[model samples]
Each structure stands twice: as structure tokens, then as C-alpha cells.
Target: MNRREFVRWSGLGMMSLLLSGCGILGTSAGAAGEEVQKNSVSGGNKMKIVVINSSPHARDESTSIYLSDRFSAGAVSAGHQVFTFDGANEETHPCRGCDICHMNGPCVFSDAIENKLMPELLSADMIVLVTPLYYYGMSAQLKTVIDRFYSRTGMLHGKKSMLIATAYDSADWTMTALSEHYATLVRYMDWVDVGQVLGIGCGSRSLVEKSSFGEQAYNIGANL
Candidate 1:
């Protein structure tokens, strides 16, 4: 059975607004405006999808972007809404391990995750995390935002989710930590696991451009 054994489908910046594909981009228009990311694709059914891109590299050199672009392109083509955020570029700080949020209020800080992503994430039907594997785990940038999920964490439950990760090493264990972390998140949050596209051995941008990883990403998006 394929990861897409079932079908259903599903950014960041000023939430680089809009999912563009099949000629009908919703036009979130990268308010912060960086280019080369076209994850939108051709399909049907409308879902509000949020993409968190956590690669700190330049768009041209980031293998993670190479895969995320194709995945989202297929999604946009399939008629879902996409909001993308570059967590790495945004001014988001690490969690303070505070429990004020547990007191039924918002977080202590008004940083990027709070100011920008929280609303979109709260209402989003699905969430797609795009990142480059870092030290056997997810990028610290992405983790900081997730840790802030301490605030209103329960509101994020019961949504669909996916992960797209790129790594240079092709070892059998290359993605284990990240994969397990993602698995633990969905299980704990009661989220539906849409699927994951782990681009193993995808080190350089040039290599990723020619790899089937991009195609796999596109297929996942198209199906969703």
C-alpha cells in the first residue's frame, strides 16, 4: 500500500498568501516576497493549507525549497489554499517553557508564530512542514514555533498534516529522528497523518532539481 492509501488534501511569510496552480492562484502573493517556490498544483476540493518552510539557505541553494515548491504546486493545482511562512527568516524566538498559556491565555511573546502563523494555523484544515534535516532532527527555527504551540495547543488538534524533509546523508537512519518526531506530534495532537515525503540523499539544490524527490513531492500534492 502506498502512503496515499487514502486521499484528501491539503507557508509563511506575511504568509506568502495563496495557493497558485491550474491558473487560479489564491494570491497570498509573498507579501514578504521571495521567489522560486511554486508548490501549488492541479486538483479539486478546497483546503486551507499552511506551509512552514524552515530552511535558512538562499532559495536557489536550498534543497528543501526545491522539494517544497513542487509539493505545493501540485496542491495549488489541486485547489487547496496555501499560506507559507519562512520561519527561518522571520524574527521568531525560542520558547521560554512558560505555562502562562496553560492558564487559558495566549503566549507571553508577540513574535512571528504568535503574530503571523497562529491564526492561519488555528483555522487551517491541514499543515505541511517543509524543512531541511539538521543534526538528526528538525531545524531549530521550526522547533521554536512548534514549542510555542504550548499556547492554544488543543485548538490545533484534529487537523491533517504532512512533512517534507530533505537530507544529504542517505544512511538508513538519516531521517529516523525527524520522522519519529513527526509521528509523535500527530499522535499526541490527534491529527490525521496525510503522509510524508522524505527526500533522502538530496543534498545539493542541483542534485535535487534532477532527483525524483521533487516528482514524489508533486505526486503527494496532486493526490491531496
Candidate 2:
């Protein structure tokens, strides 16, 4: 099917599953027919994961990128299909406050969301947002994508989500505001908040590489 058709059908399928009381969005079955705990990756079922890497650096020079890579590695090791999107590089347009999406179907804009993100998002079992802290908040690039999500309101409920935030400051409050915003988003979307990994005191790429945050991120991915 074409991308748009795929997205439409996927949304419909998700709604059907939800109404029928199936637990595909979060639960899985263990080998012995036991129920796998939510957010646990022990079962052999392969999850569809979408990683939104919002760091501006193209290389592994940023802590956010480094940690996200580690998470992706762990998820891959557990046999999950992971798709990473470079938010900084995507040509995403800001939402124009028009309610065209509500009147029609998804967003009316012919941008990355229509051509790319929406399809993957509709089909993803989990979403990982990786961002470098900017002014005690998420990057504008990532925020733009979040704003565009308005087009798919009521279509993304129950999806699991995780967050990874990196910052140079070592203070306890380094990412407090951003974490609050992330929590608000999770609540608004009615998605599960799997976890959040904070990589603090990462002044340089080498420091992040040497920090325990990488291992923590990897664990989160593996346990997803």
C-alpha cells in the first residue's frame, strides 16, 4: 500500500485492537505462556521502535547522539526493529494553527510528517526521543515535530515512549523543566512513559562516552 493508505489502515487497526481489549500496544506473551510485564523486552516478540534523535551534531560528538546510539544498539541486540530519524536534518514545518487536520484526515501540510514520520509513527510500538538540553528545554527542532503531532490527535494513544536528555550542567535541576514537559506530553497523548535517561555533566563527547549514562541507556533499550 502507499504510505498514506498504510497510515490510515494502521490507525484503524490500532483502534480496532484497542476496542477489542487486545494488549498489542504494550503487553506481550512469554515463552511459557506467561504474560510479559509491561516495558520488558524479554519476550522474543520484535518491537517496532522509532528514535527521534534531535541533536544538531551529525557525528557522535554530542552526548545525546552518543547515548541514543547506545540505546539503539541495545534495542537491536534484543531483535527490535529500530528506525532513527534525525530531527535536526528533517525539513519539518511549524504548525500553522490551522485546524485543517481536524476537518480532514491527518495534517494537510505536504511535509515530512505526511511523507515520512506519520507512517512510521502509526506503526511504531515505541518511540524514543533523544535530545540535547537547550535553555533547560528540548531543542526547537524536536519541539517542531511535537507540535506537528496535533494532526494525528486521538490516533497515537497507548503507544509507549521514552526520553533521553543530555546536558553540560551537573546540577540536579539541569533537565527538570524538560522532564516536566515530557511528562505533560505523555499524559496528553495517553502514552506510556517507559522511562527517561538523563546524561548530565556531559561537557564533551569524550565525557559522555566515559559516563555510566551509556550503560543506562543501553539497559533501557534492552528492557524495552
lDDT of 1: 0.73
Best by lDDT: 2
Which model scores highest in TM-score? 2
Each model's total of backbone clashes: 24, 0
Model 2 agreement with the true structure over 17-112: per-residue lDDT tens digits: 333222222312121223542425334477899998888886558789898898898778767889888888877888887767762347768887
lDDT of 1 by residue, 80-156 (tens): 78899888998898878666666234878888888899989998988888889999899988898787776766677
TM-score of 1: 0.79
Q: Which residue ranges in model 2 land beyond 4 Å of their true spot?
A: 1-44
Query: How many angstroms is residue 120 displaced in model 2 relative to the true structure, after the best TM-score fit?
Result: 0.0
